[model samples]
Target chain A: MSEVKDTQGQLWEVFIQTKKGLPFKHFGSVHAYDKEMAIQNARDLYTRRGEGRGMWVVPADAIVAIDSSDDESFFDPSNDKVYRHPTFYELPDGLKNM
Target chain B: MDNLNLSKFCIRLGDHCLIMAHRQSELCSNGPFLEEDIAQINLGLDLLGQAEALLIYAAKLEGGTRTADDLAFRRPERQFHNFMLTEQPNTDFAFVIVRQYIMSLYLLKTYQALSKVEDDTLSGIALKALKELTYHERHFAMWLKRLGDGTEESHERTQTAINELWMFVGELYEEDEIDFMAQKASYAPTGIEMKTFLMEHITAKFSEATLETPHSIYMTTGSKKGIHTEYLGYLLTEMQYLQRAYPDAKW
Candidate 1:
């Protein structure tokens, strides 16, 4: 299908931090006219269920992503680096979260 | 403090919330876009939850057999004590935002006072609802600014809405017998105090939005006696249809 024209302002991606010490995870996107509106729309859409303690909204166009054509070159090289898994290391007994 | 008067007071507040919730619900699927649609519905749900809490407390205080559902769905137009402004029709998006901005500010101040009252139940409910109303006030205030200052057409529509709704605001601060009694019992702030605070805040916000407050001298009044605009009855017909058709029907 052809790309549909959008008149609903700008697109914003929402990230939500479920707890104070945790990092914000990508939740979803919403359409808004400005930064304040983007934040409010993210709040109304994603945080209605007490889902987050903090939120961040970024313009959708600001994100940079690799194209699908580059997936093989970008990801295949990492698979052969088995020593990077840190399996040869030994940990002390009291280390809990390592 | 008279239990009868206190119960009536709770019913008045609950009716305001219930009717406002119904009005917001009317815009559920009709918002300008999907995000706005969800936002409006979320607002309605917040009001609905508040209405349930207040009405349940009112029923308990009255020692009545009627449940919150009965209070919401079974009351006739004349029995509802909501302010006339709450029942006003959503003539347009500008009207809806303007109405919400006014009512949210009114409720924010009222609830702030109630949160400090001597009554535990009412004060507790007010404390919790206060948090929600804070966001409601901010959201609408933002919209009011955008619409008021956006474009020529939007500015005109927003100004017209303010001019039309200005008259109904007087009813919010008119001290009736119930309000007088509540004030005597320290259950609420005095009408003059609330009016002063509301008008000052409204003036400041309107100035920020580049909107002028109408100085119309003919302020309408009468919601204290269960009187409302003609729009309320039709709204009730639609809201109460299922319950009226099948008495005691449950989802």
Candidate 2:
């Protein structure tokens, strides 16, 4: 019964999965008065051309993001960590599906 | 009935979708919001696709040089046989949703029955149309509920639309002479059964939306018999303008 409308509409971010077992990718957002209409809007907007097999809608306000403007405080610590990269290690020769 | 009769009936069916598409396109870039605009366009596109296939089949059945384009653009207002409900003016968003909701529900029942007809081509068309119709019915249904239960003005506007358009609902269920013949040949379903299903679904949806239903039992008919409202003339004037002004025009 998630619903949105013109009067009390809330913005919902849309995620679409093109196939089963695939990750849902963020497409965009739509304002809807109810959950049903939100999903309908997503289907019409995001999947009209059979672009996706599944969809997830969450209120825009539900998402929390790290403050990107202050990049050095958090994300920068991992930006140049070459040891964390798989390419940094040499794989044993001929390791299939590794 | 003869092939001519069957074709005539097919024209009526095609006209419903074509006219509805024509009317809804009037809302292009005029929707309440961007998402709404996109939704309306998708709905119109679906109607347009269905119209093209049905009219193509109709033109072929007529066994003449006439094409779907000819039937769509060249026919005078009197020759076009679309439901009065579909040819209605888009007075407001509420009206558009209500009128569309009614037609979509009607289509859902009729198309489902039509998909099983003895004629493979027509049945295939019905199957394709039903998939499109499924989304259409839901789109309008969702809007109808939102408008009917939203604001006082919205509720009032929607109720007025339903009251104004309810009288025409009878015509969708009426089996005309050609329709009866099509039913006998298993090319189409009986309108009465579809009407019953439509009414039940409409009633349930109305209650959920908190919308009022018109009590008027008086019915209006004539579109199927080549008679139409004054609105149709104006609509045709705009829709056929490009083709009429420039014969053999192409995109």
Candidate 3:
């Protein structure tokens, strides 16, 4: 058994997919003793109303996240690149598939 | 099929769920861990839902002024047909999980059989219940393995629980005269057949848990006839307190 690290067992980040082929969006987090319990607890906490068709749970500690302090360094450079967006070009009114 | 027997059968199943769900629900704020507390509460709610559905079906088949509420609340101690095992006290978490494991195994077999039957309502309910029971069975089964093999105290506590609760397993297979009639009319499954699956699965799991198979020949009987341990009356007192105190109370 994993040592009881804290009152709320291991923190697991939960992601839920509403239907098949849908991307698993971050739903919330749950506390559980281990991987299976994490999935079960995630199911109970996140899927009570049948809101999910698929679920993924990862340990919160396993994630690698950029600090908020790095926001300027990571994403600020892309802000001025309006040409990278589809709206930069105007499409013909009759171009249905475009 | 005879309406009396069929309703009685439904009530029997309902009573088991109701009584056991009550036990599980009592742990709402008492679980060893927060996650476990929530998980068990969810399980209790699932059983409560299953009980209500079955009880409503029972009331419907009985075809009288008696509603599901009346059947569930107004009934006296002797009228309930839940197993003695279910009404047994939650001595500890190990016993609780052991009790759930036993009942879940029986319920899995029972509902699986029920899901295959012809009655639309019963089959539909069983099918729905099977989905929930899958997770419930897994939850307790994992607990059994965890507790049975974890620390020395956990292993000992759970091992004793298995032995203590093993006697109650016989009552689950104890068929009544009405049960025979129901089975003959294709209204119910042969419980003995269900026990075969339960025993096989239980033995394998128990062995994996490093627990000895209970070889004790002592078998506690007499729950289907509304006979139960001292636990049932006390359970009823708490369960029926609201209804008894305030008749027809509703949200």
Candidate 4:
């Protein structure tokens, strides 16, 4: 009856909410054969009291991870380019809300 | 039974939380890693919080000078009524998972039933606790499935845990006259059967996990009456040491 073993389950990410009016932030990952199983696992892993409103379980392989080595050239130059900081320029009080 | 009798009943519920919280507390700084360690510790805190609220209610019902602390620290092992399931030593991750899985299911059912209690305080406590326990159930249930379906080693260990612990599930439903009294008093639901619900949920969970269900007829008893397995005494000793040693030492 063990058609698909536990080991064959795929990894899926989870998100959760701690209470009402909360967002379902990324919580953790669980392994399951399909989306339905993944959602169930996510419910077990993420929601307890109804702690989670919703969750999205993407296969572990589907995520394109950014390489750590590209940290310098990828974004370091932006630090010296102060123009990117919107806070650097003071806007008049008329545009304060904007 | 009168409210005095009901106090004893509430204490039994408190004892369940206190003992389990005490067991979970040992995990502080001893979790597998930072996140897991924090999670277990948080779980311990939550269980203790639940115990505190229930015991305080019990103290009020008794119409005596005793407080929650008295019940928590001064009570003997034989006086503390909790299920044997919560009292079992967390021998490994497998045991921990099994304990959480079983307790979560029980708490979910218990709190849901208790939410409609006539007592405003009891209903409030149940309402708050119900939210927390829902998460507890989900967390352990997910892990049970993962570990059951994970590596061969993990699967084997978890299956062993399930088989070993299966006998204790019976205690969750073993109600007596006291429970019936509580039901009649509107302290809890009347004829609320937990066995069928528990069995169905666990059976489905095990099936999904591909874990073999144990067939042992040796169901442990006496937890409802405050009698316990051998492990409870040692657990109570450590748990009560502070209060026992320094009587009235509290904030």
Candidate 5:
């Protein structure tokens, strides 16, 4: 079948924070015409099960992603950089979060 | 504190939620999009939850062998006390949104008043349902503005819906004997208060939406006395079909 035009308005990505002090993780996406509609749609779609205490909606097109073809060049070099690893430095016994 | 009237009052509240929930549920798979479909169903679920709570309380007030399920499934058309607006058909998305906007406005005010009533159970139920109705009112109001100002076709259709459903808006605050009894016992807001609030909010919201409020002087009434539009009978038939077919059916 030929591709049909989508008239359901713009796409939005949803983020949900399950608690007040927690970070908002990427939840899902919904189609809405504007920011207000996007937020409401996200609330209805992603938070219906009480899974979220806070929500954020961003335009799907607003996100910038790296090209998959550059994955090896961009990411593989970091894998062998042993000195950059946090475990490479031994922490003193009294050290805290470090 | 007449138990009979108070019980009847609870039934009226429960019936409104039940009928409206059923109307929302009818559009389960028929929403314009997947997100919208789920949203509408979620609205239905919220209303159904409120209905069950109100009906259960109504049954308790009656002090009978009746369960909430029995009150919901066994009641006949003439016995239901839902507002006529709640039973209107979802002709289109515009109609559904308009109907929901009107009902939500009414319910929000009603629940706000009920939350402070003398009765503890009713007040508790109203407080919880008030939170849900707040979102419901805002959601529908947003849709109303969107449809009213979005496009020419949408604007025209939404205007048509507002005009069509405007006739039933008056019945929401129509003062009847039951209403008087509830108001007397501190169980509900006065009819005048409800009417004034509804008129002011509706006028302001309509202006914001760039929609015209109908100038018609004729308003339909009579849901309080169980007199409803013909559409309700058909709706109840479908809703009660399973229970009527198998009297002992269980979930």
Candidate 6:
């Protein structure tokens, strides 16, 4: 069982968008007891300029990020895969929404 | 009951915001961490922005030559009508949060009440400010719960902060001539209505935080009538120093 009680003061990863139709970007983290409070606290702390239409607060522990120490091995193969690029495809004349 | 009264009312409103903003601004560099420091300053800026808006309206109401800077800087400490809660020193993160938590709860209701004022200016101010206070209330409500229930040390510290600040809170809802004048002018909520609403609201949050409410004791009242704790003088000195030192000097 994931115990919230034992994980007090744990970090939360906050993502926010400055407005609707804007991409969510990393803003900041706050130490909170739960997801709801974390998001509210993030809104209070971050979106003062009407800078966000929405926010996402995920507990840092819940994020399974790839280890940065293994960055070269884990990400290098994908980086060199130019064949994965959409540039390989010729665009039609009216291919407006790339 | 004329524009003069309206001006005074708005100045009082601005004073509340400016004093609280200055106090919160003091937290920017000194928060427990970078994130909280940013959050505290965000609130501080919100309050200062609100003060500017209200003070401008107050100046117009007075039909005075003075600007917001004049009122904010030229007045002596005795003339400021802000609550002592806003003027108190930021003792610690817990202390600041507790004070804000309680004040947010009260201010949420205060603005809601103000929204019904007959004065268009007051109504507009209240409506817009209500939106800001909604988030403020939510943010601190969460902190109050987290700190209260997080750990033994956090709980005890938050509880102590709440108890110490409880005395200052009563002044927020304490009605006097100003409130009565507001009511008479159809520009304020009745004290009875505001009190009942705020108490029930605060009680629910306290219950959720799993903390016992401080017994209603030593709840001082009088800030609205210009009486304040000793701390107000020092805060005014800091806030008004620049303006006082160089009167009429423009940026």
> Each model's C-alpha lDDT?
0.91, 0.87, 0.87, 0.79, 0.90, 0.79
Chain A alone, model 1, TM-score? Answer: 0.83
Ranking under TM-score, best-scoring first? 1, 5, 3, 2, 6, 4
Docking class of 1: high
Residues B109-227 of candidate 4 have per-residue lDDT tens digits of 87887798777898898899997888777767877887899899999999888887787787888878898887776665444467777778888898898887776778888987778
Q: In candidate 6, residue B127 scores what lDDT? A: 92
Residue range A29-59, candidate 5, lDDT tens digits? 9999899889988988888788988889999
Candidate 2 DockQ category?
medium
lDDT of candidate 2 over B1-251, digit per residue (tens): 67787788778889999999988799889988878888898899889988998899989989978999999999999899999999999999988999999999878877877898878888998999999999898889888888888899999999999998888899888886787787787766688777778879999999899987777799899988889888999999999999999999899
Flag regions of model 1 displaced more than 4 Å.
A1-5, A89-98
How do the residues B104-210 of candidate 6 rate in per-residue lDDT, one tens digit apiece? 77667767767887767778888988888887877778778888877899888888887778788777767777678877776766777777777787778878887
TM-score of decoy 6: 0.83
Q: How well does each candidate superpose onto the true structure, as a TM-score?
A: 0.96, 0.92, 0.93, 0.76, 0.94, 0.83
TM-score of chain A of each: 0.83, 0.76, 0.80, 0.67, 0.80, 0.71
Give the range of the ten consecutive residues with the poorest summed lDDT in model 2 chain B: B180-189
**Which segments of model 5 are wrong by more than 4 Å?**
A1-3, A88-98
In the range B37-129, model 5's lDDT, one tens digit per residue, is 998999999999999998898898889779999999998999999988999999999999999998898889889879998778888999998
Determine which window of 10 residues in candidate 3 chain B has minimal summed lDDT.
B185-194
- Scored by DockQ, the top model is 1
Off by over 4 Å in 2: A1-8, A79-81, A88-98
Identify the CAPRI category of the predicted complex in candidate 4.
Answer: incorrect
Q: For model 5, name the residue pairs that clash.
A: none
Q: Over the stretch A1-98, how does candidate 6's per-residue lDDT look in tens digits?
A: 56555533668989997777767798877886567857766776777667778889988888888888999888778756677877777889987536
Evaluate model 6 with DockQ and give the value.
0.38
Regions more than 4 Å wrong, model 6: A1-11, A17-33, A44-46, A60-97
What is candidate 6's CA lDDT for residue A80?
67
Name the top TM-score candidate.
Answer: 1
DockQ for each numbered candidate: 0.93, 0.57, 0.59, 0.10, 0.84, 0.38
Q: Model 1, residue B15: displacement in angstroms? A: 0.6
Please list all clashing residue pairs in model 2, or write none if there are none: A2-A35, A3-A33, A3-A34, A3-A35, A4-A32, A4-A33, A4-A34, A5-A32, A5-A33
